[model samples]
Target: MKTLDFKPKLVSAIRNYNKQTFMADLMAGLIVGIVALPLAIAFGIASGVSPEKGIITAIVAGFAISALGGSKVQIGGPTGAFIVIVAGIINQYGIQGLTIATLMAGVFLIGFGLLRLGTIIKYIPYPIIVGFTSGIAVTIFTTQVKDLLGMQMDAVPSDFIEKWIAYFQNLTHIDPWSAGVGLVSVAIIASAPKFSKRIPGSLIAIIVMTVVVLLLKQYAGVTSIETIGDRFNISSQLPDAVVPELSWETIKGLVAPALTIAILGAIESLLSATVADGVIGDHHNSNTELIGQGVANIVSPIFGGIPATGAIARTMTNINNGGRTPIAGIVHAVVLLLIFLFLMPLAQYIPMACLAGVLVVVSYGMSGWRSFTALMHNPKSDITVLLLTFFLTIIFDLTVAIEVGIVCACLLFMKRMSETTDVKAVYDEIDLNEDADMERGNLEHLSIPKGVEVYEINGPYFFGAGNKFEDLMGGFGDRPKVRIIRMRKVPFIDSTGLHNLENMCLMSQKEGITVVLSGVNEKVEAVLRRNNFHKLLGQENICNHIDLALARANEIVG
Candidate 1:
């Protein structure tokens, strides 16, 4: 196998990082940081952790991924994808467990990159990807209802259906003020781009909602809803690294969650990188990006951060705002760092409902509702794979969803491929065109010889399509006096396909009948020689085309 190689272009634009680009990146970074800030906090809280973890992830993991990653504009941080996994880890094993799992996941990512499995990851079926992605979106959206509506629930269960039931049971207790803030926040953030492109709607919404809540508190003295400070005390101190306890029992328990984190992180990060490539017209080194993300996840957990990956929305904002290099990603991280140190206290006043609203939008985007519905319009095989993966993701766990989805896709693909495999009687009508030759050809007027059969396979000879060859050969009521199997149309044959050919040859030999092959492409012929099928069936029987094989068949019969 030829090894996969990529040549990195190490061109420098630092000398030309003129004031214009710098200012653009600076502002873009700031805007993305603000957008990320509330998101980081909300994601962390949703994942069953404190607010600081999310910010720390944005600062530490975000910086590491951008500084070392392959893409020029990818923004890395805790995304909506990890909410369910993180929550499960935290619920089952605690924060220490989550940290250990994150670290282990990092190791897995690095190993995957080192093993050069980057290209193989792309083979993951589209239906499976959409299925779990849509499922994750729904899960995130459901998780935020309690916070968005200001419902008083001590703990939200992890099960999907149970959580919804819990939400509806508490529907009557919704706080009207918090609901109003969430709805307004959503509107302002959603409609911000219509008014101005430079400033993000989320930041504007946060400011507007925050100031409104502040004025209400100061003037109207309304105290119905909770804020970040009331839920978890805010601190301005820089987050410190905490060493995780790596006990045998903890490692054993964290293995599954760690694998889940690693797989989902790889999927989301690569997907985001691919999306960035399209937006910027640049290709990303997937293996290098995976390694970078691994390092980020590994290091961020030590600093009290959660699992992180390349964030698509943030990366898009960076690109739209003229952030054209990795420097922008680094700047974005630094911008968040400054906010964490200086503006942490101010963030306390940003209502929890505002954060919930931001995440609501995040969930909607991540859910990819448009694409999910679009997938329904695809082929039935694709629809089956999509719905299977989606429902499995919602009902069970993501790992299971992915496992089953891939398997289902593989089975469905084999089924389709098998359907494409056809055994045809090509005498007088190979192309099936309505032109001359078929009715007037010499062979067309010739009478069929008793106990002689001819069949042509017209596609790639892979296992799925290969097995059907036996059925075609067996379709003859009795063993033919001679059989000519034409394989000129088969571009290539895999091991299983060759094995089937050998079986057909052996069966013909046992019946004291001759089997001849015609139009064998060089690749398939090479496989036959390598498998010693040529010797078993005699090289004289194998010809370059159907005409030569028919001549040889005639000689054998005479």
Candidate 2:
């Protein structure tokens, strides 16, 4: 039985807990919490929910993930990746549906961890990952255009093309005051790092822009701009936990959205953990992290929070600020909760345009343009997967893009594998000796017993190569009394390859021929042994090298 390791990183960090580390974690957590405040709000609003929901996510989900997660510095909350899917869910099924779907996704994540599928999730192709990420960036940028430009649209279209068209049509309704606030917010966020690395640029932008917009409206009588207070009510209290009522029909409808949330959450969290590992020189338990994420998602939605995952930017912030343990993540969550309890009313004064500006900067960071451009010079298959995933994400949605990208990548990979796998007949020593004599070269002679044949197989013996092996074996007009298969270059075998081998063995046995396997690697031999293939072929028939196999074949022929 496989032993399951459910140990959280927090427990390990606590074992060596010291005052100095606590101070570092406290300060780092405070700074990260400040940085998370505006982003949480922005992601929530962009996801078609109230700004407080974002804060709720950061506080509730953030705390749970930190306390139970595998990574020390990972910060979990609502992120830009969820905006498109969340908005679609809200629009189609309403908030209740979204709640149920998020809950289902949480269950899925827990299952993923319990099944120990963490390593498998990391194998998703880089091109597909980049493609969807870049696509999400584009989608996020597009979604923020209305607020950034202060366009007077009642509602932005969910469709990508239609959304752009709506933006163009509403170009005349752009408010200069709102645009000014947004641009200044962007400028401050972009340049604030030069002044002080300790303070986040987005936090600075939020503070200064909010005060500026407030002063402009109160003293100068500017009425064109919109603030969070003007749009949505800022709740100062934590939401009560409530179970979403579900029916069979509702459950059926929500499965796809739930799956999308679970998959994206898993991918983003794992990626963030991996990045944090590089920064801190620590390995994270991926399965444990997934379980933590699952628990967070399950608990968060009950408190009016959306699906949450590890935020790469916030995790980096924690690391840069000297956060070395999960305590910092816990502190960050506590700080956000405090802000929600006390500073919630003040947040209402924050300008929507400024938040939009913050999201635009976020979109820029998530764009992955550098990686995407680099991939253009890669193989045509990779490039194709990237482009296809990108366009499909924009045209349809992430679900379709991910599905198509994975399928396409798999097919292309199989094609390459098949191309590498080959089966060729090994010529007898007589033929080689004849050619050597005619060529007049100092060549060693080789001899083979009559009614003995040899064949060589190269590359992995997987499903893709099964047909090639079958075709090569089928062309043999006459059956030899003894046959040797040279597999020195073969690395591994799959069920399909094993099945084909079994068929070959049965046929050879019926024809009174002995089949000898040569140079089978340890991995392949393990599989053969597990399937009792060696017993079928007889232990004496298996050899470590071609010479031994030839000798064994000679004995069999004799």
> Clash number for every model?
1, 0
Cα lDDT of model 1 by residue, 52-123, tens digit: 889989989999888777677889999998998888778778888889999999999888777766667877
Residue 430, candidate 1: alpha-carbon lDDT:
40
RMSD of 2: 4.1
Model 1: residue 228 alpha-carbon error in angstroms: 1.1
Give one digit per residue, the lDDT tens place, for model 2 in 338-454.
999989999889999999999999999999899999999999999999999999988789878988999999999888987887887765563434331123246455566678777
RMSD per candidate (Å) reads 3.3, 4.1
Model 1, CA-based lDDT:
0.81
Error of 2 at 175 (Å): 1.6
TM-score of each: 0.90, 0.91
Over 4 Å off, model 1? 1-20, 247-255, 426-450, 474-478
Decoy 1 TM-score against native = 0.90
Worst 10 residues of 1 by lDDT: 4-13
Maximum-lDDT candidate? 2
